[model samples]
Target chain A: MNILEIKDLHVSVGGEQILKGLNLSVEQGSVHAIMGPNGSGKSTLANVLAGKPGYVIDRGEIHFDGDLLNDVDPEVRARAGLFLAFQYPVEIPGVSNMEFLKAAVDSLAAARGGEQTTAVEFVKSVRKIATALDLNPEFLKRGVNEGFSGGERKRNEILQLLLLNPRLAVLDETDSGLDIDAMQTVADGINRFRDAHNCVLLITHYQRLLNHVVPDVVHVLSDGVIVKSGEKDLAVTLEERGYAWLTD
Target chain B: MADRLEDSFAESLIANLDSSSGSWLAVEEIIDRLKSSLTPAATKESWKYTPLRDFLVGFTGAAAVTPDITGVNQPGLTMSALSAAGEYARGPAALANTGPLPLADAALLCAGDAVHIKVSGEIAQPLEISYGEGVQVPIVITLEDNASLQLIERNNAVEFCNHSLFVELNRGSRLNHARSALDSNCCDWGLTQVRLLETTDYRLQQYHTGARKRRAETLILLDGRGARAELTGAYVVESNSHLDQQFIVEHRSPDTFSRQTFHGIGAGKGTIVFNGRIHIHPDSPGSDASLVNKNLALHPEATINTKPELEIYTDDVKCAHGATVGQLAEDSIFYLRSRGLSRDDARTLLCRAFLKSCIEGVLAEEVTEALLRNLTGP
Candidate 1:
């Protein structure tokens, strides 16, 4: 079943159009990889999906789990099982990571009318995810992403993705600034998070991340819209041949 | 005409004190300065941000009420009234430099009899002093060598209050001072002056919720070598409220260290001003001092002014100072929202986080909770 369906989406920021006439679909239980060069509107698409302010959806129809996503509040979209792992995670100096996570979890659970997770269970789950991502459990005590390295920020985003357990995950260039080992760890986390009930939308610039978490479908985004769609092999082809061939 | 008005007000205050307690000789010099130099604050660099002259133009001084004191019954501590401890309370009011404002001296002169607390040893229990409505009282505290005390000062629903606090920390003494000015819809002027002797330590934790017209001034003198002082404060200004905080930390002895960190948030149409100044005397070589003032403007109409001033006469000292006025980061708000928090919740979280630096400790917990509870939507 299609978890997300976008038709004729046009997005603009500050009156300058970025994503023009974009259409895509991601099926449940599948991972879709989006590859593009700089200024290809990849991040714009990710932000648009998250309903970030200043990103005007000029014209589009975004359906997430059979609900219209246009003009929907970000928190509303989040509570509806959508999550975005930021490319550059924000550094909040005084709000501890543990506190932020608890608030997020409680908010989501309350919106879903589910029982709030107890403190012990929440801490255990967070520790488990942090350990799996090679993150020090002590990081939870520190401010959100405060003084974290580039690789550690990406790992922290993945930890959020796993902990939030949203139905559809959008990873925006989460592998841009990672070493081989960190990338492998993040990839393992993404692989572990993928199941038959949910789906993943992986946005990236290089095909290296695809080698670890191979996507079922690869889409090449150029100028504003997705210009090519194929199997996982297409990511390697684009990486070798360069985006010039497709853009030209 | 304004000068005459100011002088008349000063004379009235002096007369009031003279009738009750005839010890005007101790603070006569300060009163003389107050009469001569009560000019319009607009031209004065220190008082420019605050319109003290305007606030005083229509101001009729309030009645005096004694502060409620507690926890002083412990051993090694002595409490007395300023009238009885005549010569003992003289030195603090007559200190060489009391900044450019005469507000402290006025508070001293107007207060019929102040509170005097003396500590001779480590007082395990904390002393709490609470000010009632329309109270203008000056407090004097002296800690002997190797003595330590935790002093907490609180203002309770004060309509109009003037407070002046003086402390002398002797050699190797330690003072942990916590203050809360949480009354709203009132006019308040407060002054806190402290002198630390050799090897003495002083720590201040202050929390304030803004009032209709409020100005708080703090002066710290690190007078002896190896003396240390740390001052931290947080304030939240609501709609139409005004808060002006002026602080000066003077390193008069070599090897003295001082740190000041304060954070304030302006919610709605209020005004918040912070002036942090650090002075290092030429003889105070090896002085290490730093001041940080951060302000958050929660509403578009809120006004915030922050300035960090540093004066170093010696070239061998380390001094760092910074001031910032900004709104919450939009990206951070969006990040929180993306994590399932509503816009309001996200803003509250960021604000609480911003104030966390200055609002953490057992002493600050109650006032902090109260301030957060009374936080109005921006």
Candidate 2:
């Protein structure tokens, strides 16, 4: 089944058009990769999908799980099973990582008519994911992403994706700052969340991430529109030849 | 205009003096000191940030006696509240109390509640005091040898008002005092004074909001060996309100340490001012002190004035003070907004984080929760 559909979407920032007329679709349980040169509106697409303000949507329609997403809030979209792993996660001083994750989990669960998890249950459930991501248990006690190393921040985002278990996870440059080991850990976590009920949208500029977590479909975004679409081999071809062919 | 207001207020204070009791003599002495020590319109360096002229204009009436809080029930306590008391007693309560100084405010002498508490060499219970509208209160607490006490005072004012407090700590004694002022619109003036003795330790935390016009003053005198003091405060001003805080710390003996930090956030057309000074006397060798003031402006028209000063006569002391005024970080706000949080929620979250650092050490969970709820709103 189609989990998300974006058609003829135009986005502007500070009154300058970025996403001219983007189009994409993803089926449940599939992984879609979007790659292009710099300024191809990759991050802008992720942000607009998450309902970030200032990205004036001049025209288009975004359908997520059969609902029009133009007016829905980011939190509502998140609760409806959409997640965006920020390229640069914010550091929230004085707010412990544990408290933030708990709030996020509870908010999503409550939206789905699930009972709130107790403190003990939450700790237990989160520990497994934390261990899988090779994150220290003590990291949970520290403030959200405050003073974290580049690799540690990437791992933290993956940890959230694992815990929240969103239906359509948008990984926006999640591997941009990660080292080799950190990238593997993040890819492993994403694979664990990839099941029959959900899908993944991997947004990036490099193909290194695709080596560990292969995409079922790859789309090249240029000038706000998908200029090319093919199977996983397309990423490898683009990584070798670059976007020279797309201009022709 | 400033002289007119000062003269009129001073005159009203003298005219309303009750000539019957010894307390009235103390009130008169305070008025005399105010007239002599303060040059009505002198524009002294210390009063630069505050509009003393405007404040004096509203102080024309006689200092009214705060009604007795005989029927009000004491607010309940929490574990965090108790812990704050314990921390204060163990750290700053080992100094001496040399009685009331002569030049201090005399209204403090007459109206202050002086409680003689024996801390049993440790803090036993968390102390809580609640104040409502039209209440002008003064309190003095002395901690005995090796005794410690955690004192929490919550101030809620409803109408045009004034609230005053005076505290003195003795040697080998410790005092942890936390105050929250949530009702600020009812009053035109508010003041707080604190003094610590030799080897005495004092810790004070104040949270204020919702005032149309408010002013807070804290004065600390470190006179004994190994005396130490810490003062931390946070305030949120909204609408067309105004808030000000003035702090002075004097190190009179050797081996004294003091630290002060004040944080403020202003929205709408609100204005905030913070003036802090640390003075190290010639005899106060080996003294260590620091003061930091930071303000966050959330609206285009909001205004903030922060001044941090250090006056040192002793060359061997370590002292530093600084101030900063700016709006919320654009990157931080954008990051939160990208997470699907509305702009309002994102701003609220960041503001709460900024204020939490000042009051996180509070021992009363209930008070902390109550404060967070008030700041974040429903």
Candidate 3:
């Protein structure tokens, strides 16, 4: 079963075309990595899948977990097991991390007709996940991403992904700005969440993260469309040669 | 031009007043001044957006005084109604110089009896006062040096209410006061005055909601060095309700610190207005003051007007003021909703967070919690 299938995906932002006739398909349980240079509409694809506003869909069809979404709100898409780890996680001051996570988890589970976890069990599980991700347990008491360092923000996003267990996780540059140990911890989390019933769409620039969370398939995006596709070696080759050769 | 009907409408309130009505001379003085100023909402340099005329119209001519006082008298507390015998043991000194507004003066002129709170030692339990429907009374609180008190005053099911509260904190004294007015179809008006002596600490948080027109104005004076004050407020209105508040925080001594934060939410065709002013008097060097006012217009027809004014006369002082009148942050809302929460739940969470930011600095956790529950539904 395909968890996500995008057909002729054409997206525009702020009166400009960003994703022009892009196509992609992620089979259930497979990890797909889309690598691109700056301005290649990589982030645009992630945002469009997450159902952000202001991005006009010129023409496209997105089927998530076998459900076609032509007019689904962002929250609806999220409850449908769609998750996007933002490139820059938004900072919501005055909302404790614990409160936000609890609401989020509850919404996701309730939408899927799953039983809710008690507050105590939720805290214990979240604490274990935070510790494994090298995140401070005390951070749960603080405001969401308020005054956190860049690395800390990235780790916090991973913490959400680990706990949510979404069917499709679109991580936009989740490994950026992280030290070596932190990157390894995040990669381990991604690896643990991978299974035959879920999918991962990893959008990134550097190949450093692909080492730990090696993708099953790699695609190079340029000018809003895929220009190259290959195995894991494609990322290593692109890493060494860079996008200059393909563009010229 | 001031309308004679409006001026006379205010005049009618002073006629046949309750025990709150003090000396005839003071009452006459207040009435005479209304002919010109008429309690603001004019083209005056300050107070332009608030149309006091609409509010004063809720004044049903005569003040309604509800003299019901319940609850046990704790060891460190004293309670009274406006007309009970010997209530005059406390004079009008607590209510003096606290009012220049016609409504405030009019409310004072109707003062029948007063509830006085005198604290000379530390009190851990909170003191609550509920003035029944249309209760007109002045609350006087005096704290001796090295003492502290927590108080909550509530006005329920009232119309044309004029309650006065005065607090004086001596050296090293701390006082936390919370006032709320939430009666539908009522016009509630309140006046609060505070004097902070040397090393005295003062904090006040108010939540006003549900009235056809509700207004509370507070005047605080930082009178000695090392004095500190933090005032937080929230106004919630829906379905044609109106909430207005004006605050004046005066820094009179060096090393004094004061902060003010006010948040308002208007859901229907309601109107919310707040004017906060922080005055750094001359020679009050090393004083630090800041004021922030924000309002959320949940409905397109809802009106929100927020202003933060700073009058700095000392060059060595630090002062900052800011105000914003708009809807909730679209980005925050989107972020929350995108995380799987329903749209309504998303808005509730964001709105609660916005309100918490206003009063989180206060030391009264229980008071702040109760206020949050009142402002934002369960």
Best prediction by TM-score: 1
True contacts kept of 2: 0.41
* lDDT (C-alpha, whole model) for all candidates: 0.85, 0.71, 0.77
Model 2, span A120-230: residue lDDT tens:
999998888899999998899999898999888889889898888889999999989888888899999999889989999999888999998999999999988899999
**CAPRI quality level assigned to candidate 3 from its DockQ score:** medium
Chain A TM value for model 2: 0.98
Quote the lDDT for A81 in model 2: 87
- Rank ordering of all candidates by TM-score, starting from the highest: 1, 3, 2
Provide the TM-score of the second chain in candidate 1.
0.91
Residue A226: error of model 2 in Å? 2.5
lDDT of 1 by residue, B1-378 (tens): 635656577876655443355354566566676676565333467666676654453234443556788998999999887663334333543442434346655555556567788999899999988876654567889899999999998877456776677788999999999988887777887778889999999999989988888888888889999999999988899888889888888899999999999988888788888888888988999999999898888878988888888888987899999999888999999999999999989988988888877875556668767777646534
Lowest lDDT 10-residue stretch of candidate 3 chain B: B85-94
Better of 1 and 3 by TM-score: 1
Q: What DockQ would candidate 2 receive versus the native complex?
A: 0.37
How large is the C-alpha RMSD of every model relative to the true structure? 2.5, 6.3, 3.9
User: Which regions of candidate 2 deviate over 4 angstroms?
Assistant: B23-31, B37-123, B126-139, B143-145, B160-166, B188-191, B329-344, B360-366, B373-378
Candidate ranking (DockQ, best to worst): 1, 3, 2
Please identify which of the two predictions, 1 or 3, would achieve the higher lDDT against the true structure. 1
Better of 1 and 2 by DockQ: 1
